[model samples]
Structure formats: structure tokens, C-alpha cells
Target: MKKFVLKPKIYFNEGSMEFLKEIKGSCAFIVSDSVMETLGYLQKTIDYLNETGIESAVFKEVRPDPDVKVIAEGMKKYLETQADTIVALGGGSTIDAAKGIIYSLWQFRKAAGEEFKKPLFIAIPSTSGTGSEVTNFSVITAEGEKVCIVDEWMAPDIAILDSTCIQHVPQSVVADTGIDALVHAIEAYVSTEATHCTDALAEKAVQLIFENLKALYNDASNSCARERIQNASCIAGMAFTNAGLGINHSLAHALGGTFHISHGRSNALLLSAVVEYNANLNSNDSRYASEKYARLAAVLQLPARTYREGTINFMQAVKDLLKSLGIPNRVRELGIDKSKFENKVETMVELALHDRCTPTNPRLPSREDLVGIYQKVF
Candidate 1:
């Protein structure tokens, strides 16, 4: 039997951050990054909590591509604070780190036979990427590999989407994360686990991203565009969380972890190659994936006389979009040493094949196929 689940209570809009003032908890623990602390978002969050007479503590150690040690340390803080609520306030990395902390605490409590109550988890995303707020997935770096941990307990109980938080994001980040959302929609639409419900959400997310990403890139102050893109990110997250992701994420995780590339940028760099690989009618035994790509093209109002034409146009559109955003289409262009990348290709392929996101890929890639795709992008 197939099942669909929607877990989080999402609160969005211009004043969504004020929702923090409604929390009934007496104590709150915030997990975020140094950038957020520097940007005053952490203080802003604490101010809201304070208005409700809630005491709060901040852990500002979350880094890009959070590692196991970081998560462990965050877990320790979480337990030490014994807060009734936990707030994850940053991009994907911060939210994921917060989830990791909560997950570890749950495991520890269960193993020790101690009575424990899961803290009310809240996710306030400062970036319009990763949809980590609503999803029950977290990626942590361990021993130079990206490890994806999935469990229902990792999902935030509440998600806040306030455009004010993303207003100051750099144009480059806007491009990288916006494209990441597009990839999420594309992958979810073509995933073997996709259902009608997931397809609807994914389609809407794709449309929102294609229509507003460029506008936001050109003018970050465009509030309408920012809100739309932010909504699209969460929508795509919902779709992927339910339908599961594909090799696009698998490859991105492996590549990002190995080379210390930014997650969204890595996904952007590998998107076209992965799309072509998945849509290869000759290589893949199933036409379903190609048909889905064609449908996506149609949604974007691209010319689609045939499925192959639609697929080609879609790939070209992706390349064009990346170029317009100043994103490099190839890993070589990203300044990774060719010799170093080549030496690590086998390890990357192994790690990607084992990634939790790979099983739902429309086309199950062989090791050779993965290597070829990496080399093509290289």
C-alpha cells in the first residue's frame, strides 16, 4: 500500500516570524550559524521569544555542511539547556543540524530507558532552499562523506516562512538555492515513488521556480518574487519528502562532501548532466522518466513537438538559467583540480550509489553510468 503524510504546521506570510511570540513554552533553544548571529537574526528570534516571557539560549556553531562533531556538540547543548522548545533558524545546514541534535537526543533517551518528551521543534528558514524546515531528512558530513539520516522524528513541528529573513541573501545564494528547488521538483516528479498528490505539488513548485527565480535574482527586493520562491522551496520539499529524491541529490551529496562544495552549488553544477542521464531514452528502459520531463517542459511553455525535443529544450533551459546566474556548468570550471577529482571518482560513485536518495531515482544508475556523468560534468 502507498501512503502520504504531511506532518508540519506551517505558518507563512509577512509577519510569520511573530508566530514565535505565541509559543507556550517557558524555555527555547535556538540552533543556528555564525552568519545568522552576525546578521542579527538570532537576536531577532530571541526578541520574539522574550516577548512571550520565554527564556532562550543560542548555539551559533552550525557551519555549512554540518559535520558529526558539530551535531554531537549541538546535541550536548540541547540536553544541557533542557528547553521545552527548539528553534532551528538558518538555511538547510542549520535546520539539518538542529534535527540531528534532536534525533540524537531521542536516541539517547530511548537507549537509556529514561522518560523524555520531544521538544517542540520549530524551523525558520533564512534561505529559500533545501526545504529542510518541513522535511524529515538531515544530511551530516562524516569522515568526508555526506550521511543522510531520515526519520519522522526529525521533522519540525512548526515551520515559519517570513520573506523578511531572506531579503538580504546574496544574489549568488539566491541563484544556487533557487536552482536547487527546481531540481527537487524535477526529481520528485520523475521519481518512481511519485504519487498524484506529490506530482501536483512538484508541478506547482517547478512553475513557481521557473517563473520567479530570475526575477528575484535580478531584483532581490522584489517581495512578491521572494515570497513565491520561498513558497516554492517549501512546496518542493514537501514533494520530495513524500515522493523521495533521486540521483541528482545522490550525486550532489557525494560531490559536495568530497570536494567541500556548497550543497546548492554542487546540485546546480551537476543538474544538466544528471537530467540528460536520467532522460536518456536509449539508455533507460523506461519511457516514463522522459515523458515526465516532456510534461515539465510543457509546463514551462517550451516547444515540445516530441518528448525528446521537450527533454532537450528543458536541458538547454537549465544550462541557460545557470549561465544567467553566473553558475558554472562544469566541475572543472569550479576550480577543482582535475587530477584530484579523477582520483576520487570511484569513491564518489560508491558513496552516491549508497546514498539514501538513490533508490527512488527514475533511472537506477550503474557505477559506470555515474562515473560517465561525473566525467561529462568534469
Candidate 2:
């Protein structure tokens, strides 16, 4: 029988940070990046914890696309602090790093035959991307490859979405991460593992992204838009966590690992091509993905004279969105040498084919198929 699981009680809205005050803990260890510290968000979180009589410590070493070394270091800090509570405050990287640290700590204790109580894991997202707060997936770079680790224990116990913290995010980040949320929704919608539950969340998430992303991108201070997109990100995350992802993520992970492209930007760069590839009616034996794409187009209110037309319109819309956001559509446009990409193309394809996300893709991609897709986008 198929199963669906939900955890991490989510708190959102203007005063959502107050939820921290209610958490039962003596000490809290915060995992975040230097940027969050620079923005004073770290201090703001600590202040909340302090109000609750909870002592706190901060580890501000997380970076974009955090690696195993960073996780190992963070794990060390977690142990040293021995905080009863762990709060991850930042984007995907910070939340993912926090999860990795906690996971590592659990494994170490278990391996040593030592009793360990699970820390109260809380994820406070500073950006409306990745939705790592609600998901068990963590993408850590290891030896120049993005390694996806998923476990029930990795999911945060609480997810606090405070739009106040995200209001000052850069417009470029808004664009990159907004598109990433859209991709998450789309991939989940078309995943072979999708159910009515996942599809409902994915459909709403996609609609919210389409309606609010551009507005947030144009005016970062629009609280309504910001809130919508933030919720959309979490909604999409919930959808993908249950439905599973597809080749879009697999391809993005491989490309990001090899070229050091930012995760959201990498996903945005590959979106149109991946959609077109997935929507191919002639080669794909199954009509399920194509129908799902058509449904998504319908949700966006794009004209759908036929399934193919709807699918094409969806692809064009993605392309248009990328252009408007100043995102490069081709990998070469991002300054990678064409010859070098070609040389690494085979290796990337192999990595993607073996990615955990690939198995759930509606259409099974062949080696040649993946190569062609990469070449076209390159």
C-alpha cells in the first residue's frame, strides 16, 4: 500500500517568530549562514529564545551549497553545545546543514551505544525556497557531487515562516528561488508517485507561484506577495516530499555540482528544457505526464486547444519567466566553456541517471535521451 506522511507543525504569518518563545528547551543551537548573521536575523532569533529563558548559541558557518566538511564541522558544534533545541535559520542551505548536523549526531550516538534524546528541531526559513524545513531531503555536496540524503529523522519538528525576515532578500534571489518553488510543484505534479493529496498541494503551489512570483520580484516589499510565495514554497515542498521529484532535480543536482551553479538558478536554467523533454508525446510511451502538464497549463489559465498546445504554452511560459527574471537559459550563457561541458556531459548524465529523484520520474530517460537534453540546453 502507498503511504503519505506529514510532520513538522508549521507556523506562519507576521508574528510567527513568537512560536520560538513557546518551545520547551533550555538551550537552542542555531544553524545558519553568515548572511543571516549579517542581516541581524540571527540576533533577532536569539532574542526570541532569550525571552523564553532559553540560552542559545549560533553557528554561522553554513554557505550556499554546503558540503560534507561544513556538515562535519556543524555536527561538531552541535555536540559541543549539546543544545536541547536546534533552530535552522536561513535558506535551503542553512536548514539542510542543520538537518545534516542533527542526523550525524544521532548516528554517532547510536553507533556508540549511547542513549540520545532527539533534539527539538526547528527550521525558520529566511527565504521562500527549498522548503527544506518540511522535507526529509538534504542535498549536501560531497567530492564535487550533490548527495541527497533522506530520512524520517532529518525532517524538522517545527517550521516557522516569518515573512518579515524575507522582506529584505535580494531581487535576484527572489527570482531564482521563486522559480525553484515552481519547479518543485511541477515535478511533484508529474511524478509517478503522485496522489490526489500531493496533486492538490502542487496545483495550489504552482498557481500561487504564477500569481505572486513576478509581483514579489518587482516589489520585494509587497508583504502579500511575499507571504504567498513563502507559503507556496512550503506547499510545494510538502507536495514533492510525498510525491517524490523527477529528472528535473536529478539534472539540476548534477549540473550544480559540476559547474558550481546555484541550486535554484540551476533548476531555473534547466526548467524549460526539462519540461519540453518530459512533455514529448511522440517518444514517451505514457500519456500521464503529458496530461499532468496540460492540467498545470489549465491551472495557469493558459489556452489549451489540445494537450500538446497546453504543454507547449507551459514551456513557453517558463522560458518567458526566466527571461523576465534575467536568468540565463543556456549553460554556456552562464560562462561555462562549451567544450568543457561536452567533455563532462557523459559523466553528468550517468550521475543524473542514478539520482534518487530519477526513479520516480514519469518518463524513464535513456542515456542518449538525457545527453540530447543536456546538449540542447547547453
Report per-prediction Cα RMSD to one decimal: 1.1, 1.2
lDDT of 1 by residue, 182-268 (tens): 988999999999999999999999999989999999999999999999999999999999999999999999999999888899899
| Candidate 2: tens digits of C-alpha lDDT, residues 1-378 | 667888989999887998888877799999988888889889889999999999998899999888989999998888888899999999999999898888887888899998888899999998897989899999999999998888888999899999998998999999989998999999999998999999999999999998999999999989999999999999999999988999989999999999998889889888888887888767646678878898888999997778888887887877888888889878899889999999999999999999999999988999998999899889
Give the lDDT of residue 274 in candidate 2. Answer: 85
Model 2 spans with C-alpha error above 4 angstroms: none
Best by lDDT: 1
